[model samples]
Target: MKNLTDMMKQARELQSKLAAAQEELEKLEIEGSSGGGLVRVTLTGKGAMTAVKIDPSLFNPDEAEILEDLITAAHNDAKTKAETVVGEKMKSLTGGLPLPPGLNLG
Candidate 1:
C-alpha cells in the first residue's frame, strides 16, 4: 500500500510537470526561412502558423507560382522547427523516456 501511494504521488507530480511544459510550449515562437531568406514563416510550438513574410522582389504576378512554392517551403521549415522544439521539451520533461506510440505533445 505504501508503494502504491508513492507511485500515485509521483504520477500527480509528473502530470503537473507535463501541464507546465505544455503551457511553455504553447508560448514558444519559432521562425524558419527559405529561398535565401526571401520567404519566412513563424509558427507556434504547437505547429500553428502565426505569420509569414515574403520579399517584395518576388511580387511579380508572373512568378506567383514560384512565390507560392517558396511560401510552402518556408512554412514546412517552420513546422519542422516547431516540432523539434516540442520534441526536445517533451524529452526533457520525460527524462528521455520514449512516449507511447501515436502519442505526441506537438
Candidate 2:
C-alpha cells in the first residue's frame, strides 16, 4: 500500500537522522559542576566521562569522602544533561511525535 511504503520511507529517513545525531553526540561535550564549582565533570554527549576536576583544597585525606560525594554528584549532573541533550535531539528529529513512555533511544 502507498501508506505503508510512505511510512517505511519515513522510518528509513528517521533512522539515518538518528545515526547522524548519535555520531554528533559522540563529538559533543558537556560540563557539570558541583560544590560551588569546587568540583567539575566533563562528559561526552553519550554520557562517557571525559575529565574530572577537583579543588586542591578538597584533596585532604580525611575529607576524601566529601570529595567522592562531590565527584558523584557532578557526574550525575553531567549525565542528566547528556540525556537531556539526546532527548531534545530526538524530539526535534521526530518533529514532536509522541513516543511511548520509557521508549529510550539511548
Top candidate when judged by TM-score against the true structure: 1
Instruction: Name the lDDT of candidate 2.
Output: 0.92
Q: How close is candidate 2 to the true structure, as a TM-score?
A: 0.90
Candidate 2 Cα RMSD (Å): 1.4
**TM-score of every candidate relative to the true structure:** 0.94, 0.90
- Where's the lowest-lDDT run of ten residues in candidate 2? 97-106
- For residue 62, give model 1's deviation from the true position in Å: 0.4
Model 1 ranges with Cα > 4 A deviation: none
Badly placed stretches (over 4 Å) of model 2 are none
For model 2, residues 1-106, the per-residue Cα lDDT tens digits are 9999999999999999989988999899999989999999999988889999999989899999999999999999999998998889989999999888987775
Error of 2 at 97 (Å): 1.5
Per-residue lDDT of model 1, residues 1-106, tens digit only: 9999999999899889999988887889999898999999998888888899999999999999999999999999998988888888889888898989998667
Task: Output the lDDT of residue 8, model 1.
Answer: 100
